[model samples]
Target: MTQARITIDRDFTVAEVPRRLFGSFVEHMGRCVYSGIYEPGHPEADARGLRQDVLKLVREMGPTVVRYPGGNFVSGYNWEDGVGPVEDRPVRIDGAWHTIETNAFGLHEFVEWSKEAEVEVMEAINLGTRGVDEARALVEYANHPGGTYWSDLRRKNGAATGTQQDPFGIKLWCLGNELDGPWQIGHKTADEYGRLAQESAKAMKLVDDSIELVAVGSSSRQMPTFGTWEHTVLSHTYEEVDYISMHAYYQEHDGDAASFLAEGVDMDAFIDGVIATIDAVKAAGKHSNQVNISFDEWNVWYQRGLDGEDQPHNVAKAGWREAPRVIEDTYSVTDAVVVGSLLHSLLRHGDRVTIANQAQLVNVIAPIRSEAGGPAWRQASFWPFARMSALAKGQIMQLAVDSGKTPTAKFGDVDAVDATATWDEQTGRLALFLANRSMEEGAEVSVDLRGLSASGVRSAEVLTIPEGGDRNSANVLDAQDTVGLKTLQEVGIEDGVLHVKLPALSWSVLELDVERA
Candidate 1:
């Protein structure tokens, strides 16, 4: 196999990227909520039952906004069940995962956790099985500052301190979660969901106009209602809603790393398709507001099926008496590469894609892993996300890379290298994240810094494992340590081109601290 080369030109610039595009999601599914963030008696837990260790790690991830309450779990969930006293909370069957949901962690708990983690909440209301009234009630409860029944109920539930105590100051909201899939509890057709979403959004806005609403788009690019769903939903609610939500998950069940790496190529097209649909809605001439996208749910999940029939839901629940960690997929090196590519794609399209979340936060296909009563450790996926979240501030610079192609089962021959660049003008630092998806050969990359003249490269870090498909095999209880970034020597400018070597099947971040010209 021949080596590929990537060139990043600093002259190309997109709009001033919104910082909220790098947001994350935390659902109430599996251990993501129960044991993941809200375990009360864990050695590291606090007075509010949130694990402080986990909170510290999440704060480091630098999530600007977090979507809450559900993925598929929201369709069947009643937000009212999770509030009030723990003894009054009901144990309901979670139809999405076929497990019992002990309503121990609810709306108030998530708000508290968001506060502790120092992130804003992107709340979602139940639209499937429930209607506009419940949705409006949730908004009034969270956003309204007293003078009403719901706000008074919140005060009674212990959120009363000051004017700022209202967690409903939440800026973003999703109308519902995945109402198009057959797996959804009250799955509706395009017309049904679009109309319901419009009404819900209208009512929600009446309660709080400052809050932005995201209409439910297709669950995936391959869904039966892919283009039709977005077109219809936007046609109905485009005027009332601020953005549309999209969800997708990457899986390599055939165990083809090459094919898995190529999945991101589809993600690129999927995002473009969504953007086209958004433009189509604008052309329809019903509204003046531009609808952005919230890729609220995404990540690689497909580990449990390989381990057997998911341990029989009820039996698995019985195994751990309290807050059992479930649906956790220990990430692999390949997963890290895909994640890097996804992040790059989000940055590249930062103009319209406002918010992006990496599925779950902990225990459930997340970057951080936690044991029920044991220590929490950063998974392999954590390094790239944390580094990007920390350094991916300021303006996003559009990068042009020319590279060779690698064929896959899903996507035909595709580029082996994908990358994005960010310039922190204040700090005088250029951050470049690159992923070389070649299974056989490395990338001989060239950096063409156009607008900003740099004297020399400051530092380079590459995150890779010895084996191509290496995974984190250590159980949650064990001390888990996987491969991470290793720093490289600075690159000197030669003929206005700064060159660096990117390893095959590797994810790298290059930080160039330049002297201002």
Candidate 2:
């Protein structure tokens, strides 16, 4: 076991990390939209059928914006099928996960729930089956004030019942979801998707200029079209769209702990590749408008294969109500360490990456899990996400850390000490998050407060368990418990450098009060 050290300099300053970068995603698949967030009969449900408990958790997560409705499910979705009266809402077959869509909770319900959760809605259009017309109508319905066709329809549906509220004020909209992959219902070639995205974005913006559109890029780094997909798509829609959407998920397929720890390198490389791609597109077009990347879908999945037998397609329908807890990953301490590294990577690239969401918000491969008519539990991945959301804000600071590298299955050799820093201007505080990926030994880190000097360290919090690989042993009704922010202690500043000890295979968040010297 080797020890690593990290040193932060106060003189180095980087881009300001946008608060919206901490956003998350919520889909209708599995329990994410059903019992997970909209259980009408639940004791904590509100008038619109949103679960108050889930809302409370969402508020705690402090997601700036939430991507709604579908993953692969959005490709085959029909926007009109989900609107209007509940009784008349049609029941369609969900081809993405082989489930039935009740259509009971549609666009209206989601908007109301977003208001209740105190988060902005990031809507994705159905480019798989539907196209520009449907996308335009949906945008008009949400952002158009009144005196228009869709806005009037929204009024008819009770979205405009009181005080002339602007029915269509949604600011963010996705052009489509995952159109580059073969698994998608309406997968398109780079040329096809680019052209479609250009046309759709043009029409969407024409309808509402204030709204921003995100074009679909590669789904993951391993995709055959990873870099090329982004280059070609951005080439055509460079002037039309505001951001390019990227999706990636990490999984320990061979069950190697070391392999899982190195996945963050892949995430870092993915973001860098996309950033270069965006720059290339801008250079090629000689366009002044800079486009950013949206990591709208990302998390650790693949636990389903290990837990139970894969259900056959024929039996999937019957299992809809049962849901059977598909992809319910019981995250271990190792997963948290990797997630911390990923969050660090996002903050490091905060300038180019504006919006990011952790795949599904609840149940199906998510941080929050629940059983129908039962209590919910936070997974091991939940703690770091909650902590980052709470502590990560303001400007991003570049950290200089000296560390070694280790080879692994998925990401090859990667740095052992991975971290990033954020400074909150309003609170006059600096927050540093670190992930020690070494499996055998802890790292003694020395951090230098750059630019702004502090009198003394305010707090140092560690989120770790006794057993390095220990997982959260929580059930539906059991008391949800796991390792999180165990301590916050004041530290002495030695020669303007603060020394702190970070546990091996652990994640630590240190907060310091900053003052101008």
Point to the candidate with the largest TM-score. Answer: 2
Superposition error at 2 for model 1 (Å): 5.0
- Full-model lDDT for every candidate: 0.79, 0.78
Clash count in backbone of candidate 1: 1
lDDT of 2: 0.78
lDDT of 1 at 332: 67
Best-fitting candidate, scored by lDDT: 1
User: Residue 490 of model 2: what lDDT?
Assistant: 34
TM per candidate = 0.93, 0.93
Tens-digit lDDT string for candidate 1 (1-517)? 4345545455567756677876788887667777688788999998778999899989887888888887877888899888887777888877666677888788888887888888889888888899899988988888899989998887777533222345457778889889998868889999999999999999988988988998999999989879999999888998899889888888875667788887778788999999999998899876678999999988887755545444334434354333344567777677788888888888888898888988888887888888778888887778778888878866788777777787787787888888888887788888888888886887777777766777667678877764433442322346366466677543456876677777777788887775434
- List, residue by residue over 181-261, the lDDT tens digit for candidate 2: 897989999999999999999999998898888999898888898889999998899999999988988876666878788
* Residue range with the least summed lDDT across 10 consecutive positions in model 1: 467-476
Runs of candidate 2 with Cα error greater than 4 angstroms are 159-165, 303-324, 404-413, 467-479, 488-492
